[model samples]
Target: MASSLNGKVALITGAASGIGRATAVKLSKLGCALALTDVVEAGLSETAELCYTEKVIVAQLDVSNAEQCDLVVKETVEYFKRLDHVFNCAGINPTAYPILELPEGYFDKLVAVNLKGTYNVTRSTLSHLKEHADCSFVNVSSILGQRPSKEMAAYCATKYAIIGFSKSMALELGPKGIRVNIVAPGFIDTPTNASVKAGPEAVERSAQSVSLGRLGQAEEVANAVAFLMGDEAKYINGSVVEINGGLAY
Candidate 1:
């Protein structure tokens, strides 16, 4: 379409903080109304307030819950009467224990919130998204999705699954004029990684690993997402836009 999002509506999960919140604000500035959801109500409300559009709606959503995903999608479509974009930014990042010492349910929990949550939101929005001419679905993955890390098998598995799932959906939905893509981000200074970035040495070590000698910012990832969702990338689909600062690994 190569047009703007002046009258479009976007549904963003994990909109409480980080890339999700940044994406919401970016879309709002581009003239898209927002349906922002997250498990954390406080952060989500703040995001909604920061949005420049008057058509913003905030909802509490635990993306792991499929039923809740359906409800939230229904509410969004009903409130806006149309949904043109989706950002699946709801995910968890935690260092998994070594295979031998891995907790019983740790893997399953990660699967539920990261992989399954992305699937839940995508499937819920498919019905309405198909009806739109220039619809887009963007899922968030991680650089770890392509490059493995020690003691992070569970997290890596979910991210890899998202890339695969999103690409598959892109293939399935492309003929229908609905674009599906993924954003694989490297080390970013988001709240989700507050623990990992707690120590200066840890932060410096991470920066040293990137060719740019610095970690990425949430808005950098959000910018890629906004571009992919907009008409500028109308011909792009089944693609993975990596936001890592040239990580050596």
Candidate 2:
């Protein structure tokens, strides 16, 4: 069945690739108009072309920039006349390195993109979302957020922060009828993990770690985001729907 999101408007960050791109396509299939933003202009255009509808607007945006976040949200609201759902998926995953061996600036950069970036977009669109009766927000976290990984301390920290931020937003927005939720994906087969997947042994080890005996796909995560944004998840605020193929728990 099609979701109640039909004809609704959604803004998605990092919509150029991976789970973000998949979510854009999925939501479009449900008859949602999309405002897709990413730093890669060409990739954003490619994603826009693949969407189910021509109501897609592509913008090159750096989610870490507060001004860009505000501008994009303003433009989307102006164009769409209302904002219904937001998917904050723009983030960076640095090379896995132990805390002691991590570069000086790497931690700050990841936090800026992964944590503060989510905050920036949410803050920019919170008021506009309030104007709608059935609005929602879905933030993309990761399995590392739920369980710490040995060499991914910085990435884990940012993902963990996302859950906390999402829960707090859910609490604050619930009374206003704007639901907030999160999705934590694990070992998704996407370009973002091209280097990791290049190693045959790494892929084998990751697959074995999951009970499902394989990695999750971007479409799987996208489906969860769509559910959280639709009426089927009307009472699912403050929830963290993990899509890790049983890798974590």
Candidate 3:
């Protein structure tokens, strides 16, 4: 609550639920005005309500669409006057299949939403970030980016690309006072993870595989993100912080 993010304006994509929803509330507590976006309008509003920030606004858009990305950024800035931070968290999991079994269409959509979606958000916001002396961005990646797993080749590839893109862009933007970083989370409990955890056999299997005895909470990741985007992490650019409870090992 004492962090310097107070009064800063932020735009977060995929803000309807999960980590995005958690982050919206976290940032609001830090006194940042927010603009939340998601393909789901109703969920976006739900997140806005939790934020409880009078300055909060919501928009519905598919981040993978460049034009929608452009419009969302433009409109968010127009509403907030200036953009100080952004969290590119809009993403989708790849089809759980072997490489040869995956379809080209599925791969394309996954990349568009996961890898290219991150690119689209930052590409659309770069100009605004450059204009602000203290612009900061944290792109959501996954511990999968650090490694791989069977039946998760496509998802791992996309997450790995996000880390690469964040580092490369960080170097380019650092001189301009814009910071870029990646937050790589491990398996976290969510609607998706809940289904995976439902069956007793699968839950037992995952518990054995994960380093942590239990799945992670979205707030845990949101806290780490807060630090990276805050003034405390001004020198932490071009780095990928893993929030996976040592799961990658």
Model 1: worst 10 consecutive residues (lDDT sum)? 191-200
Q: Lowest summed-lDDT stretch of 10 residues in model 2? A: 193-202
Please, what are the lDDT tens digits per residue for candidate 1 over residues 28-130?
8888999999988999888988998889999999999999999999999999999999999998877658989888698888999999999999888889885
Q: Positional deviation of 246 in candidate 3, in angstroms?
A: 2.0
Q: What is the lDDT of residue 181 in candidate 1?
A: 92
Candidate 2 residue spans exceeding 4 A from truth:
194-197
| TM-scores of all candidate predictions against the true structure | 0.96, 0.96, 0.94
CA-RMSD of model 3:
1.7
Task: List lDDT for all candidates, in order.
Answer: 0.89, 0.90, 0.85
Give one digit per residue, the lDDT tens place, for model 3 in 1-249: 476899898899889989999999999999999989988778988898898478998999898899999998999888888899999988885457887898888889889999898888888988887444777999988877988878888888999999999999998888888899999887676655632536767666666666777667889989998899898988899999987766636
Which pairs clash inside model 1?
A: none
How far residue 164's Cα lies from its native spot in candidate 3, in Å, is 0.6
Tell me, by lDDT, which candidate is best: 2
lDDT of 2 by residue, 99-143 (tens): 799987998899999999999999999989854488999998988
For residue 126, what is the lDDT in candidate 1?
Answer: 88
lDDT of 3 at 104: 85
